[model samples]
Target chain A: MSQMEIKNITKKFADVTALDNVTLKLEENKIYGLLGRNGAGKTTLLNLITNRIFPTDGEILVDGESVIENDSALSKLYFMTENNYYPEHMTVKKAFTWTKGFYTDFDIEYASELCEKFSLKLSQKIKTLSTGYTSIFKMILALSCNVPFVLLDEPVLGLDANHRDLFYKELLKNYSEKPKTIIISTHLIEEAAEIIEDVIIIKSGKLILKESVESVLSQGYAITGSISAVDSFTAGKNVLGADTIGGLKSAYILGHLDKSGIPEGLEVTKPDLQKLFIHMTNR
Target chain B: MSQMEIKNITKKFADVTALDNVTLKLEENKIYGLLGRNGAGKTTLLNLITNRIFPTDGEILVDGESVIENDSALSKLYFMTENNYYPEHMTVKKAFTWTKGFYTDFDIEYASELCEKFSLKLSQKIKTLSTGYTSIFKMILALSCNVPFVLLDEPVLGLDANHRDLFYKELLKNYSEKPKTIIISTHLIEEAAEIIEDVIIIKSGKLILKESVESVLSQGYAITGSISAVDSFTAGKNVLGADTIGGLKSAYILGHLDKSGIPEGLEVTKPDLQKLFIHMTNR
Candidate 1:
């Protein structure tokens, strides 16, 4: 098992500071959701970890070894970025062969099976593939690479409803069969909430929250009732936000609910990850 | 007020038929969700309506006037495509000015206001924006175009969870203030379900279902319980799909669920739009 440690990493590009003193530990064999708003430095941090761009300060280590052009450590990692790296004219079949050359552990048979499931023709050129198919091609490679550490950035970018569902199920099945350290960076928070074991939320180039999914979800909830009743009930509580519709109101409050002291018309329910994320990051 | 009428429209590309005798109506001041699998011809239909491409058969009319080569009818419509069309070196402010020339009803003040709300700088060039920002810029244009008929193709494509939440809220607000015929085509069905008044689903270049959101969602539900219990309960019903985890099973069923005589341990809940779309479109 391999663990990645990002320590005090900082990156600046001309006038903007992309990342500032960001540090996090990616444990072995776990599914993590790296979440943030646009330009919040989620991609910057990922690029730093993959050694694509050098950090201005601090360092990244994989299994206690720095990941700065270290071929041995890099070989165990696979990053499926949003941009296509293969030649536009290359056939899907040839791209698979080329990928196998770099990652000797790549499973050709499994890739072919996935292709069949996704209805991707091996003879089709990469450039001719639609947006959805391009995403499928990259996802198939990411899943079949057989690396200890895998990073997927917006893995389901252009996938349709059915294909996205299929991808999630297949991903879970593959993970169960062979446990690996997986970090997924995506904008679809609700779809990924149930699948990710842990979550890391960053805002304005700084890490705001990092915790297990269960605990984070349990930490906050929504209470809805009459406007006056809700306002009085949440007087001293940490309220994130609220919405009013006529005489009714819904207030999102942080902290556990007391079952006995709740008012008659008020209803409390668990907040979904997307709602919580919006409240947390909506500055 | 304006209504879009698609009359037996058919489109072909070389040997492939993109759309096959599809007909639909967009009522004035209503929001419609245009949904389908990839390559199902959702974009083609939108393109045909906007006169971007000629239909091989039939015609499209806006408020009793043909759309083809009709500048007056076309002026009431705006189509926000997936690809960016603005000049690469043009600033966002300049693009806003350019759009006003073509779209006489374009609101420059509203566009600038939305840019501030989304934290998009007016001085930023179109080509230099990130994927999320690019989507935001286009969305701003669509919203401020002030046309009676507006078509948004993947408007929230790369937006984050917070931005997506904001976009939906803003869309609802804008629609409420000045009602228009809005057609949104996207893959995130559940997110758009509440905001969209009606749904139009296409499959393999043919129209499959067109109904109100309430009616479609109420037609199906999911029952979850022990494997044997779920199996016996859903034996004769229309089962869409099933998920099994150990001894427990969850089966998605179509048609109205009978309230009485349900199994003791089985729990019934609503089936989301995405689930219904998958079942409807899956071969």
Candidate 2:
């Protein structure tokens, strides 16, 4: 199994610290969710791992080998972001052919099949595509790269509902067959909550969480009841936030519940991923 | 009361039909969800209403007045799209001041307050902002324009979960305080479903469905049971699709559901909007 280790990495952009003393370990054959607010250094961390930008401190090691100036280690990783570096007039088909020159394992047949599924025209120029189609084109290339570790930042940036559904289903199918390591960075937490096995959260350039989705859900929960009942039950408890509508209220708590200590008319449920994220990241 | 009418509009680009003989009416103090697949002519419809492009057939009117080349009628409408028309060097603060030139009712103080709420720096140039921040800036402008009809095309594009939550909450607050016509075009159906009173779905440059969210949801259902049981239940029904996981199955169906007719060990629920949309638009 392949393993990547980020050890005490810190990145500084001029005087501003984009990442600070962050450490993580990613194992192969697992899908991870990289969750954070804007300017939370998620992109900076990805850049450091790919050696596109050197970290100010510490290092990244893939299979116990330093990734810096190492082409062999870098070749196994593919990072796809929103930025487009291809020529403005390059056709989608031509871009697919060009990608084959760098990545020997690029599957042109699979890409063509994906194009048909997405209803994307192969003859269309990259610059002429809409925002949603632009994301789709980049996603197709990333998926067909056949790399072990694929870093997808906002893969569904501008996709419509139907397209988003198709992409997620296709991704799960690919992972089940290939068993590769994948990390998705996206803002659509509720939609992505199901497929992502583990979540890594950052706040203000510091790692705040690294846990399995199951464990995270088990640790926290939401309680709903009358406003007064919820207030009394949440007294001195680790409350995240609460929403009240007329006589009813729902309070989010970041701790386990004792099932024996129950109140009538109160409902218990799993904590929402997006709600927890907002509560944890808010100042 | 304020109203806008779209009268038998059809837009054609060469031999291809961009929008085909569509008609709809918008009333004041209502929130509408405009939904469609990419290249399905949602943008074309918005452009036609704003008079950025004239329809090949028919016309658009605001309060019974032709919108084509009518500045007085157009002033009541504010369109916020992905495209940036501001000068590259113009900062967010400068853009707010410049908007006052065209919109006499543009609220500079409210725009400044919104910038703070969304954590947007006023001094940042429009060209230098990130994709998420660009959307935020445009949204702030549209909200503060004090217009009767506000059209937002993918306003939450590229925003993080926290920012999206904030934007929706702010939008609701803004609407409650000042009752105006608001149309939101987004792919995040589940998130937007709660706020939008009605949904308008377009497919292949044609309006497929336009109705209240409640009515649309009420008309369809989903049944879940064992594979054999689900198959038997969905047989000869208006089955949209079905999924099989191990021995369990779930089938999505259109038309009214007979709850009492469900077999033992079967569960039924309302249809999912995204699933309904996918089934409607798929070839």
Per-residue lDDT of model 1, residues B113-178, tens digit only: 999999999999999998889999999999999999899999998889888988998999999998
lDDT of 2 by residue, A118-183 (tens): 999999999999888999999999899999899999999888888898899889988998889999
Error of 2 at B151 (Å): 0.9
Q: How far is candidate 2 from the true structure (C-alpha RMSD, Å)?
A: 2.7
Superposed model 1: Cα runs more than 4 Å off: A224-237, A241-250, A261-267, B223-251, B261-267
TM-score for each candidate, following the candidate numbering: 0.93, 0.92
DockQ in order: 0.84, 0.76
User: Candidate 1 chain B: minimum summed lDDT over ten consecutive residues — where?
Assistant: B254-263
lDDT of 2 by residue, B12-108 (tens): 9999999999999988899999999888999999998999999999889999999999999999999998799999799999999999999999999
Winner by DockQ: 1
TM-score of 1: 0.93
lDDT of 1 at A221: 90
